[model samples]
Target: MPLPKESHYTLADVLSWEEPDRVELIDGAPVMMAPPSRAHQEILTELTRQLANYLEGKQCRVYPAPFAVRLFERPGDRPEDVRTLVEPDISVVCDRDKLDEVGCKGAPDLIIEILSPSSLRHDRLTKYNLYQRAGVREYWIVDPSARSIQSFVLESGHYTAKDLGTPGDVLKVHVLDGCFIDLSKVFPEAGV
Candidate 1:
């Protein structure tokens, strides 16, 4: 189901709300998040595990949602005035300055989102444009049902290259050197 968007809200509004359902603010609109499916969780786990292992003892860190990411926030931006907030299924932040108690205050080095039926369009197009505009360096969209991944790497502030791969392939994280995710482990049941 597409998330309901009845009223406009800001970072301050989101921070103040105590609702149970997780949501993301897109240009001041709230997008309700649905729970992940078993397959989605499985892929997310393997991907997060791989990224975490590679990041251990390193400066960069990986976080799985519900980690808030204020992608467009800049210096002196007020919470009530600033609007965009996102929760990538996986977020990798190399800049420690952006880290805060509220979550990441700026665009993460890399972001990964595992697709669900209700969120397929939102993730593929809406979030895709948002992340690209926010200057997220690398973004990956994983289709759990399809057992495939579509990757976009930013070049010259635009996503210039696209990499599509299946469960048997290996994907290198451009933001993290010497780091890779084994696709087979991400969706072990794909080839069976």
Candidate 2:
């Protein structure tokens, strides 16, 4: 049965909200997001460009930040019942069913979060635990300041991570078989 428009919202209300400030909801609490820096946007651009290029004509698709992602959806759950809502720097979703007009219903196939000064702890700790608990297939924490990236793959209901410290390092996406991220191009400091 098709749900009535207002009765059920995957992210419709959140996306169409009048609030200009961006915030993420965790455990039903709103956490304000700081404005991103130019460096942050630049890194996001390179990463998004790489992912988008690889996903073209493929079943999977990529979405950049400002897209809503309601994680851990359960049967008969309303939008207000969802405990976590995040805006990852990049989201790659392979299952079309999880997607809706406003945002994604559950965990994306792969999630990438770029580090910012204000978001460091939130991304590394808070979101790390959330994504792991939600069974996110792959999670990446990109640290531009450190010129490193940590890739985590869900194995046996837990995340096992691999860190690529050098800017020239390349990481093959576990979920997307043929996809690889070349850090050299992702960071301007690479090959320095």
Candidate 3:
């Protein structure tokens, strides 16, 4: 389907509405996502724990899903011209000013989206373009079924992906300098 006209609901209108289980405004359309499966939630939790552990007391702050990060319209655009609004499975924010009671009001430093059977295309394609256009430094798509993590680093307005499948692979996020994740521990029961 084609995108809606940019005259859709404004952020204030969206915020004033009753919250849904998982509602996001993407390119002027409200995309309702189903609740993630047990496995998806498990992986997200584990990843959040690891990120928190690594970023503890550091300048960067990590957040779990249901945290909306809004991509505001440009200077000449209307308030209703929200480029995208998504709640990533996990996100990191190094900038303090963006943090708010509702959620991060701007692009996050890093976004981690765990793939589910129902959201494969959105996670890999729709969201991929959205984050890249918003200038997100890094984005990760973790596929539990494949037991793999695909890390994408935004370089000059595009994203370059790195596929880390096995436990032996050193999981490194380019934007998170010096941060290292041991894939072995991330997917300990990969063969199962």
Candidate 4:
């Protein structure tokens, strides 16, 4: 079920939600998220592990989902006033200052959202625009069914299609400097 259209929710409201279901806040409205499939979980786990390994001893840190990402449009916005909050499948934060006890307070350097049936539209369009506007340096849309990945790099405040690759190809992270992921490892043929 979708969140009510008449109601406007905030970051604080979403955090206070007692329901076990996961949700994201977009434009001050709560958007319910569907449970991920086994394939999705596998890809997420592999990507997280690979990224965590690459970022070890580095300034940047990676986090998996169920993590909060507060998207405040303006400076000095209080937590209660901030409206947008999302949990990308994987988030890489290069700025240590954004790290809080809860989660990231600002946009992450890189965000990877593994596409699921319910999230295709939200991740490709709504969250795409939101992340671009919020200044996310890189965004990745991983398609488990297709066994492919599409990466977008932020240029001049807009996300540009940087790379699209299948299982045999390798994808590089522009924001992570020299880090890259082997597509075969990310989308194993035997798994999905």
Which portions of model 1 miss their true places by more than 4 Å?
1-6, 190-192
Which tens-of-lDDT digit does each residue in 6-123 have in candidate 1?
A: 5788888777666546888899988888888877887888999999999999999999989999999998888997788899999999999999998999899999999999898999
Q: Please, what's the RMSD in Å of model 3?
A: 3.8
lDDT of 4 by residue, 1-192 (tens): 334445888876655656636888787777888788988999999999999999999999999998889866455777779788898999999999898887898899999999988889999999899899999999999988888999999999999999998988989999988898999888777835
The lowest-lDDT stretch of 10 consecutive residues in candidate 4 is 1-10
User: TM-score of every model?
Assistant: 0.93, 0.88, 0.86, 0.92
TM-score of 3: 0.86
The CA lDDT of each predicted structure is: 0.87, 0.82, 0.79, 0.87
Candidate 2: tens digits of C-alpha lDDT, residues 1-192: 222334333343454566545777777666778888887898899889999999999999999998888888766777657767899989999999899875888889999999999999999999999998988999999897887788999999899986564577787888998888888888766344
Candidate 2 ranges with C-alpha deviation above 4 Å? 1-16, 190-192
Candidate 4: list runs displaced more than 4 Å: 1-6, 73-75
Every model's Cα RMSD, please? 2.6, 5.6, 3.8, 2.1
How far residue 58's Cα lies from its native spot in candidate 3, in Å, is 0.7
lDDT of 2 at 64: 93
lDDT of 3 by residue, 34-137 (tens): 89898888788878888899899899999998898885544454445664678899989998888878677778999999988889999999999899988889
Which regions in candidate 3 have their CA more than 4 angstroms from the true location? Answer: 1-7, 73-83, 190-192
